[model samples]
Target: LLGTVLLGARRFRGGRNPQPRRAPPSPTYRERGDTTESFPLDFTAVEENMDNFMKQVKNLAQSLYPCSAQKLDYDMKLHFLENSSVTCNDGTPAGYYMKESLGSRRWLIFLEGGWYCFNKENCDSRYETMRRLMSSSKWPQTKTGTGILSPLPEENPHWWNAHMVFIPYCSSDVWSGASAKTDQSGYAFMGSLIIQEVVKDLLTKGLDKAKVLLLAGSSAGGTGVLLNVDPVADLLERRGHTTVQVRGLADSGWFLDNKQYRSTDCHDTVSCAPTDAIRRGIKYWGGVVPERCRLAHLGEEWNCFFGYRVFPSIKSPVFVVQWLFDEAQLTVDNIHLTGQPVQEGQWRYIQNLGIELRNTLKDVPAMFAPACLSHEIITRNYWIDVQVKGTSLPRALYCWDRSFYDNSRNNKAPPKGCPVHLIDSCPWPHCNPTCPTIRDQFTGQEMNVIQFLMHMGFDVQKMAQQQGMDPSKLLGMLSSGS
Candidate 1:
């Protein structure tokens, strides 16, 4: 209702977009098909949507980085061009495939990484390090094969051979400026479109909606995950009350979605927000720099959405495989839950899995692989998967970890570099040798947070819903007009 009521039928007022709602609809894979790409921006806010809280989040993100960032001239910006290629490979007209197998396994709709639509945006050192982190934190080169994931290749017995689709966040035609407004929600449009295409094709091909997996890389794609997952769940649940859980959510050095550092947002929290994560992200992801240098492109500097408040509800099981040393985008704030840092990567990974199982047992199975991973190390995990066993499960927390340094966030080395070559290794074989199998520079042997998840089952959503939990439930945040 927030995005709906605020954005009604007016022209984009500019500045930050209000919430977001249905434009009038002409309205598919069934989910994105239902989404219409006609809406305006709303610069009409005395305060951000969440008001005080949004200010706090943005300030927190901004304070983490201290260098003077380049301010947007605003005159140099671009919008949806009448002819910009916003339609090329919109992620539609594609089929889902297993990254390593085929024949009849679970299917996944994956997206590629490329944080900025403009190749020029990669100039930032932090952005570059984030790219390196992606090599480990997301689909590996050995696995995805030059960006095109091999759907259901007949190689492994456990290969989840099923229909899968890969959606690229920025269309080949979208160019750079097509979405410099409203927090890049336009990218969400592309993601939704791809989801629509994949769904229609899947249904037409006889695949069950409940069996679909939604995956994205980096921030824009991750935002797409937020936009698509819940809607996909709604569609699948409509078809089969017992929907299958989405298996893996490959997030790599993702820090700018939902909530990011911004002006007028993190006013007070700026002084107290945790700096360790930012420092660490700067250390490991910035490649000798800090997050500010990386995110300098964002003129608004608002934590529009954070992992704590953005992860969509999973109809099926889910997996979150992050790195132990990634430092691209650091923060203790949980952007996925919409606003719950307490439920971040491992925490939310656990909480969400419980929620999924509570919703369905066999249909949704949770799994995880820390891969001794980090925000930037995701792409490497795919290569590490060669040593990782079992299919990617839905358990919230699973696979890899080590806290060599007590308070690992700070006092850590810079986000210098990573083993970016791992992405090419096909389904890195599962072999969790006790010592750093890949001769990893980092070390920690904490695997399988299943028991912890089972234990959290007692609280999970109920606890999250509690008034004084972690973020100290807003109580009225979700049910307010202003």
Candidate 2:
């Protein structure tokens, strides 16, 4: 199945766009929280738009103008901070990858996401297992960008021309630590200091003249953005770069502080218990929180790690992009089975998770929340496919960017169709037609190779024709595992 899907992806990348044997069944919708009433989901317009977009993608693949040129200078160079005090968990010098675009004053600095280790036991275990994350010794000299970091204008329309910086997660601190290697801990954790040093270095490399600076991250990095967005802005203010309009874009980071579906002992596993782990991690990592948040929680600095707790304290304009049913959160919360044949109680729990997320995001000035069960956005090739209310993430982000500038200047609402606060109020996961197909290991409804390839932008009919088989027959055989 994987092989067949890869073949289709390769063919599509080669610029072929064949029609499918048939369009998938039309979707059904219900008013949020209204169980009795059902509505017909009209995807006629959406399909037309998607077809046009696929055509655009096909054209870009064939021409490859921006992609070809982008490849020439998109290799981000790795730079170790000169400040010796800033180091990764293994005492290795902390570093970030930078790709400078000449003639562009806008900057997008993205922090990479890797789940953190809060205590000495987990940190030690992390070093032996995921050494590359804990140390910078094996980081590549040059790395290419993708998703939002992509230099290609076709893929990343919003900030494609901007100067891009990719900060790897190495401190095991979620980019919030301020401690050095101690005899007792046996490791340095300077995640917070590393970011400050990176900014200071960029001052010499044209950041001083930047008109717009967007700080973005996914998962743990997303949480880091919430914890550090204001500080980064204040850092620039202190350095006299007050003209730089700093903003944040957090992806898949708004974790709910809700209870687990199946409670387990804190010592059993960190993946199944986040509250206890975070509580212990704050002290072990010497984590720093924004002043307002620290004061709000007083003694419980760990609350800063949760988006709902810290978002109220953020002063900068931030655009949040999150999956309504985040897979990572479900795993940690012990809500593992989300596929078909879901138990009654577990399904209710899943629905409630989406409700909680919607309620929390209601007050956020700018956001795009889809009714899906996945993690990480903004850096995916198919980000354009996922939309809420017919607005793609890029489109929503563009509007949010414009709204920020407009409101800051004249206090006007966003333009006609540009909606920044988009949340799917639908009850269940994958209710949105634009939502990606969910693949659960334990589900009875696993996608066949044809469906998988189709989701990946392949022409199923073309694949069937090339194999000298009828598309319908091929699908039948694959379905029966013949």
Candidate 3:
């Protein structure tokens, strides 16, 4: 019965409903120490458990939806960029998913993140990675968890029923470039064009009617939100949604200009010195610099690309979410980009990044700077539970939203002396256990899986049977891990 229903579901590609393709295999649990996990199951055992659980899911799905006539829409519907020529890094069609439901006329548009690449070689490598990691074929038809994109109201109280749009990143330009194709490289640097087209499409699809708009993204997408939020808001206002309350939330995209860590040449450590990449990106993509940003920075137009520099210039109230010791800086972009050793100096550099972030965004309406070492926090399983200063991250965000909207409606200044939600787990490098970490091995995979299921509105005891684990043991593990 499940097979019949699955076969009957319309599969969309390039606006055509094609024959159903074989569902992709479940993703393997590639362990990252920075990802907060609550249960420590053996890696192999987790894989076996996942396989068993998936089988049960299939069976349960079959029983729940016995009629093949009941069509199951893909969690994210694919809509290619309106322009015929623009495509992703791999030359595949670029697109976003609009998951509409009955809720507020408010909108929560999330920009998906993948890091950027500047030079031709780096761009080519990024293109290949996009093909592997972001090919439309790789996405799951059905999203099953909670947090940022969750459809369930219990999990995402504020945003569950809003017009939720997820824009995929494929341009390797952080959605800020619009370069003409050059003979030197075959890649299309049309990220700016992609953003323009996507926004236009959304405007036509009732985004002009949005009472509230929260433009948010993670990593590169987070940077994209900062770069494009004003333009997007302007587009809506011009379309007669002048009263629409638009705000931005940049998650883990509070990138800093760590010139202290980069080499003199500036070519190798472009990630650390993001302005260099931004300069190349602007020229390559034919992107426009925000006029206010240009005037604010004056001679330093490239500084507009870095968040710390740009945050002060944004007129819209944006909530900044970041970690004090972002694990990505420690492991991926910073040291990895510059070939710097993980010494005391590197630690100081990370701390300084946080300091600059705080100083730059001190005046922003809302900020969530946790002392965790993790990178992206909003979409992770831990977002619902992870707390700093006795307030869960989500709760803090909700409160911020309430305050922001209330202030906007009432025409009142934000209450003075209100503490910024800066959650520091202090003691230098050794993070507080309660703070999220991907570095610990004893972290439990089982707990992660259980929490994920709970977020999806599943019964843990029933799901545990599939994994050949005792439900009580799973609960205990989760308790201990927490």
Count of clashes in candidate 2: 0
Best-first order by lDDT: 2, 3, 1
Give model 1's TM-score versus the native structure.
Answer: 0.36
In candidate 2, stretches whose alpha carbon ends up further than 4 angstroms from where it belongs are 1-71, 338-340, 408-411, 440-482
Pairs clashing within candidate 3? 33-438, 33-439, 34-438, 35-438, 39-444, 39-445, 40-444, 178-285, 179-284, 179-285
Ranking by TM-score, best first? 2, 3, 1
Poorest 10 consecutive residues by lDDT, candidate 3:
40-49
Q: Rate residue 109 of model 1 by lDDT.
A: 61
Give stretches of model 3 more than 4 Å off: 1-74, 132-146, 260-272, 331-342, 408-420, 423-433, 440-482
**TM-score, one value per model:** 0.36, 0.78, 0.69
Deviation in angstroms for 473 in model 3? 33
Clashing pairs in 2: none
Rate residue 15 of model 3 by lDDT. 18
- Cα lDDT tens digits, model 2, 136-176, are 99999998889889877678766676789999999888889
CA lDDT, every model vs. true structure: 0.31, 0.78, 0.62
Per-residue lDDT, model 1, residue 41, is 24
- List CA RMSD, all candidates: 25.5, 15.9, 15.6
